[model samples]
Target: MSIFNLIVALGAVTHKDSDHERVLIKRIKAGDNKALEELYELYKSLLFGMIISIVKKREEAEDVLQEVFMRIWEKAHTFDENRGNVYSWIVTLTRNKAIDRIRSKGYKTQEKASTSVDEPEFSLEGDKFDPLETTIFSDRAELVKKALEEIPEKQREVIKVAYFGGMTQSEISEHLDIPLGTVKTRTRQGLIKLKNILEDHISRNG
Candidate 1:
């Protein structure tokens, strides 16, 4: 079956038999590799799409998808149904792992450098800055600063280093001596929080 078909089938099965999911997890925890495979087969595409959304790279997303399943295999015993459903747990884990991979020093540095190299040539002398553009930029910067102030201090710090300092995610990780994965998570979460704050601010003020 196609991946989409598989996802739909799995969704139907999970929705129809939540108990079946719990049983699968229980079996997986009890050292059933087959159960783990079953879980992977069910969720791989959904998880892969999520990873691709965060990482924006197919190859890296694929790598992260593999790592996510590996994590699921090793950490299945830690899954607690009391806290959340299995689908939620797996999706969260997949997203977190993909964010971690993209936030790595190596991946960030390579991506940033490649992006910089791919831009078309532009001369400052040939293209003079417009006053309107400057004012708009300034306004946006102020709004962003205000939004940043609302998030936690650590997230604000990472966001500033990333967006203002023009540093790659990996660079931020190295400069702070923080783990690459931690940097990635912070960056992703911080940006999401910032976006929400900005949207709310705009809605109220606009």
Candidate 2:
């Protein structure tokens, strides 16, 4: 083939690729898996590169890359045509998800490392469980911790005295030197707040 003809053929190939990609995006948004596969072929390497940059491990980045695509596929109808093109959108999602996974896992690791090795020095249930039970209990414990953290400090202290220490409200008032009405109000509000937090947790977990 003549060099000039070869150059023209290459340009035609490039234009065909770009045109096919545009059609693939439109069809993928319409829930066509074939089009999604074409879109995946066009953009997978780009997506993987962005993920690997953030997550820094080939396996983890690859897993996150798949997650990003699954989200895109599941949510394609939600994508707005006015919001730039599909390639750019997929790249952004891939980077964001990979970074989020990396940060989340890193934070958990750091928290476990920083926590004391000692036990709580008291028996709630001895902290032993099968894997499934431990997962459920851990989730509940986290929810409880988050709920307690939302309470105002003084009310939380008052609650600790009444519940954990087995003191009556009147005893709590006497011990804390607060008015009985104030103690009761704090307890009431604290429990209401705790209930709200627990309801939110159930909704999320369920």
Candidate 3:
């Protein structure tokens, strides 16, 4: 086909993607075998791009891509749109699975790691979060920093001296030429205020 005809054909398929994806997801959730074909058609390129980007070897990428789609097929029921958009979920899963594979096998041949069990790092994922879960961590960190900035200059300085500078309240009092009791009170209040602001911010977000 000519370039124009190819573009027209792609446009037609592009327009159908949203509906196609929704249907595929529903069918996959319902345990339809053919839905796997839809998934391959939908995300093979994206998963391959992610695998190639990370593994950086054609054969390795292909191997990782297979693992990724297999997990996607098995975990179709875990695809929650409320957590994130479809693209983000797939990309996160693909990238993470590839990285986990590489780290396990030292990025050697594709056969070195074949879905092992009992990883120490797996349990650490309780506090561990991906960029896919929520951008809230970084956003709240910035906001807390800015909110700390909103506090009185002296309070901010004292809190920084105590928290970031690893100084005790008495040390802050000596350094800032303030009474020890005053330093302690300021430190306590600064923490309380920051905690309140953080809680309020989290509530607003959720």
After superposition, which runs of candidate 1 have C-alpha atoms over 4 Å from their true positions? 1-17, 116-206
**What is candidate 3's lDDT per residue for 47-107, written digit by digit as tens?**
5644554444567667887888788778889988665445555656776776666556466
Best by TM-score: 1
Can you list the residue pairs that collide in candidate 3?
A: none
**Residue 167 lDDT (model 1):** 59
Question: Residue 19: error of model 2 in Å?
Answer: 3.3
lDDT of each: 0.63, 0.58, 0.58
TM-score per model over all chains: 0.50, 0.42, 0.44
- The order of the candidates by TM-score, greatest first, is 1, 3, 2
Model 1 scores worst on lDDT over the 10 consecutive residues at 129-138
- Residue 98 of model 2, lDDT score: 67
Winner on TM-score (1 vs 2): 1
The alpha-carbon lDDT assigned to residue 43 of candidate 3 equals: 70
